[model samples]
Target: MKTPLTLLGLVLLTAASCSHESLTRPAPPPGDSAERGRELARRLIIVDGHIDVPYRLQEKLSPEGEPTEDISQRTAGGDFDYPRAVEGGLDVPFMSIYIPAELQKTAGASKALADSLIDMVEKLARTSPDKFALARSVDEARRNTSEGKVSFAMGIENGSALEDSVANVAHFQKRGVRYITLTHSADNLLGDSSYAEGAHRWNGLSPLGKQVVAEMNRVGIMVDVSHLSDATIRQVLETSQQPVIASHSSCRHFTPGFERNLSDELIRAIAAKGGVVMISFGSGFLLQAAQDHEKRLREEAMAFIQQQGLTRESPEVRTFIENWLREHPFPRARVEDVADHIDHVVKLVGIDHVGLGSDFDGVGPTLPVGLEDVSRYPNLFRVLLERGYGEAELEKLASGNVFRVWRQVEATARP
Candidate 1:
């Protein structure tokens, strides 16, 4: 019944009314801390400095180089998988190419194992392009993150892979290894390890270690001081032109006398050099009680192994340890304890020097409560959020700190 002009007027009014309604609509209520934390995790580019995925896969591989467990889908064992990583909002997890310390005793074994692990990681990305991508640089990581894919950034856990050659530093850098932990479990030719008992071999960085550090700097590999002895760490701080990282270490304040964890002085030294100390998530690394419990269990288990004339790798020893653990369960560290480590580092060196390295898949059953796997990173964020960490601070802790160091290392490298 309306005229054409009237109809046109009605249409325009209705359109304006709809737009007004949309503009005036109230915002949805904010989610709870946990939900908000999860949202923030998904929105941020979370980079875990060390994750032992390659070594984990290597353990499960058949003799023919085929992986027994499919990581693209959720697997029964290990801390990493595509689904869990996506759920955890993990963007860049440095795949640890962990060469065993025993290989250091062998001439060519270390390099061979290192190459095989690198091949495995490359294959993971090649076979699962949609789920994973190899991130050779920070820019590539960011790009992969934007595309909703997990970036497989790599770090060699044991510098033994260098095989007594400084040139091997450049070789690893070319192979997409971004960082190298100078030693692990035992003193290699590079330096003394924190876990290696008795007399110190190198006292600090060996002559070859100094050259390796320099070569690492020249080739753009970030030096990792995770398992290095205290003296080695000190010398590495003095030697490297680039900032170093403790890829998977926690504070020694919580677990005193634990040389594996960085001391306050060392942490400060690392910070002064513009480095990051990526806090590990292992319960043993976080709590004195947990560390003591683990030490006791290890001693008892070893005694049992010796009594039975069995090696540590024997199935009987594994079962004995399993039963012992069931009888005397480990004192698990909570998510709050992890936050305390972060707080300790922040108070000591500020938030810019601390980040997560979550030695996941490598820590076995020792991961803290609420951070049992990669998918629980949001739990740590939630605890931090409750402790008054803002988005900017959380973002820096998530990846900004490490990315800054990484970028600086890359910039310092020469052609």
Candidate 2:
């Protein structure tokens, strides 16, 4: 048996070998061309690690909770819709089944909500069979792509949904959950979250959290480290047998002191583990200025709530919030900013360790200008092309890297 140090050495060696392979690989048949980039986007299997469509849909629906929004068509408001996804050449998108941190306190609420979200995804595919298909594996994604359908992959955005039971991991896997984010806005039984203030229950991961990681590996579920604290991310990198993912994280080097984004060292560590850091497109994640502005807004909002002795649930407070948001709009990040994170990852690691994980619906209207919706993926591809990315490199950025990790995780799982 290899010692932890020996295992880490092997992991680093594997990552270096993969990195070398990507660099030495032959170029595409054609040169780096915009037209070729567009063509390749249409042909390649692009997979986004996180898109909170179900939660967004729930928000957009009527109070009665009926299916008011038809995402199967070209929807007007949100970032993702079927027609837009097809236009953007997005073949596979992991629908983030996000469970809020507060739900962690309840015994079975998170699990129930997760189940409902999965049911919602299944319903979307069932109702839009011509346009959508549920993809449980890379092969299924390929099959659905060949059939001219957009493949939907599910990722549980909070490990709290597992309810401290490792058995629930397999249960969720059976329901098509491909990955699990260790924590959300707050610390859970699993681990500490970057967003949780003064909450460092588990400096990294709790005892059960370690067991959950192993169970996930054994069940072929990718461990997502997004929203985890630096300590938790490092712990996950050390514990997981297969490569894990930062489902929707950005380079913290860009937004210094922002714990939600992965620091340069953590990014390098993840790459050493042979995992890909999927760059998030949220403006807060992309730009320091945006991050600062968001922090100010939250502070002001909290102050206002206290000054007026208003509760968040109060109608007056809601109105105040609405008016305040209207008064101070967030600065818009550009497509170039999103590309910058990708470039940072490439420079720090390599193209083999970077991919897309746009927090589309999850980011509200804070997305960059050109990448406001699913249809804008081609704009990113064009930017990459202009930045000297060839078809091979672009393909790796698009989905090849993530597919490689997914396949490796699947291979390591108990059959």
Candidate 3:
């Protein structure tokens, strides 16, 4: 193993390597990769159901996509930039208004976090009206499409944002938050987080938690099962009269031991109920090997970070972390692997239950390499085309399935 080098040193080396590659004239896309990808992206109404953009706002992340004058820029250095989204043919991105779980436990914290998220949404809308129009409903998404604008749907990443109040659910519903994950990295008032045991007062969606699910269904909010416990997931599925989505989860078949993944049985359950499972793009969440590698890298990086005592989320640190990730580069969890997950769900519950929810900015440095950022989605389209996925199947996998479930869930929620 190589001894750890300074970030400055790594940057110098990578700069040289990049120059060398440019000098060598990198290989062109053989036959039809780029063309097919272009065609595929053009046709599909891509929807990324879970992105951490609102989190980026809180963290003060900048837009990274090129064409500075263009309207569609995404977070700088982070994935899902504007030029790239247009290039990838992504039309609708359900921007996550995520509040960390800790906020729910502390009184007033949820409101504070919610206020920040709302503020960010307003800021985005105010600053980039041409690029992003809020998709308050499926009708609004369609309206945005007709107007040739990007649909910006809002979703609360954790039910903890409801903060033990039934009315808070209504508050978020009014704020255009279309979905809510039951919990996050830590268990909150709702239930146990897949990451941390959040059962401080009550674990796994207390009686209030159950009501939140029903309320979400009643209020036209989609129940997002991305971070819920398996029990919580089952409960949500049982509780919601409409189909629920595992908004940004991968298959346990692809990445085992990550409870964040929906099991084969759970996948079947979601599909049986006519719900969709948007595949996640985080390497750590996709392949155990990749995640394990990054885990060690993080430990090493953190060890270095702690030793140096640098600010964790600073630009210098972020640049350093991004460069570090560029090293252990997780291969495109192969579009085939993505298809395999889609196939797994398709076989289990048919085709109407699969969609793409690449956790672009949310996954941070652990995203799929070729699929890095929103712009790289063209690569997935190319891969899918290469895998012999036809147009009809592609449509369902791209956004049709998710849209279908969304319509149903929305219909059931209407007054």
Candidate 4:
């Protein structure tokens, strides 16, 4: 059988070539508005709803099982680190415990991986108490910020980690996990995935998924709608008593047909229910040109691999991908495009329903130009400021909106 061209495989193939040129730090923003934007970024409590730091570290484990890169200090690769997050004024970054969809095929494998990743996060906080702290609630995260530490709030990217057990929802909640994306690249027992091909398994959410949603609400976990099919999202909205969040999705209005992003109707629905849609910073998530470019590159690269009779994992295929990427350099989106997405959401449903959720370290090299990594958040703020956003509105976009939703989720839970 031909090797399945997995999303993770594609990301690895293009990561090196897709990355922007190295920068010690982003240059200081120019003009009065830029300066004010930078100041506001430092002053506000910025909460990025989704970041893939834990999984990124897990991917770089040494043979001895230790992490190769030290996030406590600046490292060569990846998007997040202590220094960069501090510079960006990022207070709370929800570390994604990303469980691969294929792991669901095995009985306990998914839950096992989730437990291991959770252990890894706990270890990070335990070892670096001064630099990092675990935040299980909005109040705790705010306290961590006051203490000058970056708060690591956890969110499971795929619900396969629940392993067909409704009981696992409460189990993860007790482990500092604040949100759970019900499905990933493939359909699970809970629901259908936006990216899953063929007919949907559950059509919307299975009976087990509805129970999971209810359990999550009762246990103080935010139900994440990102990566789920439209049917699943609607069902979740209906079933969830507390506000839900799309932890890292952009507006689908920009990248049409990209079901991975939220539609205008869906955005309004999420907003009507008092939830927030955290706009993602990936280039493909921001622009139609960038999305088209990515799709074309994948198709061409796959055709070349098959024509050359090379395995996807072969060195020859890797070299071909690098060359192809270099030759057809991806159409990069700018920081302005990111602001446009935020603006689109605000226009459709007001600012209360939108926040930032940069899929850092997860989107490979497909990040936007001015918003390349954790240290570049002020660049986005500068653009928003230029477009006439006041400090109060900017603060709402920064963390206030998501925190409100989170607090409501917490309050809705039964003791």
Once fitted onto the true fold, the runs of candidate 3 whose alpha carbons sit more than 4 angstroms away are 1-33, 61-76, 197-203, 294-332
Instruction: State which candidate has the highest TM-score.
Output: 4
lDDT of 1: 0.84
lDDT of 3 by residue, 1-415 (tens): 0001332111111100000000112343457876877877866788888877667656654475212322355445667656677877888898887776545558888777776777767667667777778888778887876776778888887776777688888888888888888787666777666666323445456788888888888888888888877777887777778888888998887566767788998998888888899988765556666645655666666666778787444456557666776765544354445555666666677667888888776765555556767777777777666555566877888788888877877788855
Supply the TM-score for candidate 4.
0.92
Model 1 clash pairs?
none
Off by over 4 Å in 1: 1-31, 305-316
- How many clashes in each candidate? 0, 0, 13, 0
Off by over 4 Å in 4: 1-31, 308-319
Please list the Cα RMSD from the true structure of every candidate, rounded to 1 decimal place.
16.3, 8.4, 8.0, 5.2
Please estimate how well model 3 matches the true structure, expressed as its whole-model Cα lDDT: 0.70
- Report, for every candidate in turn, its global Cα lDDT versus the true structure: 0.84, 0.81, 0.70, 0.85
- Please give the distance, in angstroms, between residue 153's alpha carbon in candidate 1 and its true position after superposition: 0.3
| Backbone clash pairs in model 1 (N, Cα, C under 3 Å; residues 3+ apart or in different chains), count | 0
Instruction: Give candidate 2 misplaced runs (Cα > 4 Å).
Output: 1-34, 61-65
TM-score of each: 0.90, 0.90, 0.81, 0.92
Query: Predictions ranked by lDDT, top down?
Result: 4, 1, 2, 3
Residues 1-415, candidate 4, lDDT per residue (tens digit)? Answer: 0012463235322211122221122344357877787788899999999998887888779999888988999989989999999889899999999998878889999899899999999999999999999999999999999999999999998999999899999899999999999988889999998888789998999999999999999999999999999999999999999889999999888778989899999999999999999998877777777656666767776788789887666777668777877787766677877887888888889879999999898887778778889998999888787777777888999999999999999988985
